[model samples]
Target: MMNTYSFPLSTLGLPNLMIQTSDGKRPVNISEIVFLESARNYTFAYLTDGSRVITSKTIGIFESPFAKHGFIRINKSIIANLSYITESCKNEGYAIRLLNGQWHTCSRRRTSKVKKVIKQLKTL
Candidate 1:
């Protein structure tokens, strides 16, 4: 039998996870897991509302292979987990609306890339 321990996502030290067990889904805590393409490393974190801190990994090393599935590269330093996104509006600047109803701005330079990936997600 596999041993399991029940704990809040925060206790796991993963700061990018934005989801919790609710609405009758499986009780398995869903966390944002990061897989780096360059270094081939995996890091996990939890997202508390809008703010999140990912595990220690060089910014340039990790790549969101699932970016087309909601993960977005917001800037050179971080990737936003779109699983938490609720709404988005591209009026003057690019911004992401999280499920918690929080909006985070994406740098102008990364807007195009983020948009491209998000668009692909829609088609899939």
Candidate 2:
């Protein structure tokens, strides 16, 4: 089972994430994040503004927290924000297009889960 951590600023009524930066931790609104890509032990956070932030933590560490905020692990190395997904491409493969026009293919093993989550999101 994956471990889950409560967002630190929840009590303060802020949906923000204290992401680790080179200098220290910085607060970023979760809604501003579009996706997260893993790079070995590090993870890259792509924001809606087209900016990227690198954190020195494994992607796994973020899986649970992000999930609670509507982010889904579309594949082994990527966790995408559901709100940022603009389209689903079924003709080519199990892929999704983000607001930034970047396409990410879901792994075969994760395609079912991704589809289910997308369906659920559409209902809300």
Leading candidate by TM-score: 2
lDDT of each: 0.47, 0.83
**lDDT (tens digit, per residue) of candidate 1 on 14-67:** 333332232322222234432111222333333443333334444453444444
Instruction: Identify the runs in model 2 with alpha carbons over 4 angstroms from their true place.
Output: 1-14
TM-score, structure 2 vs. true: 0.85
Compose the digit string of candidate 2's lDDT tens values, residues 32-72: 88899999999999988999999999999999988887789
TM-score of each: 0.49, 0.85
* Candidate 2, residue 54: lDDT: 96
Clashes of each: 11, 0
Model 2 residue 72 CA deviation in Å: 0.5
Q: How large is the C-alpha RMSD of every model relative to the true structure? A: 13.4, 7.6
lDDT of 2: 0.83
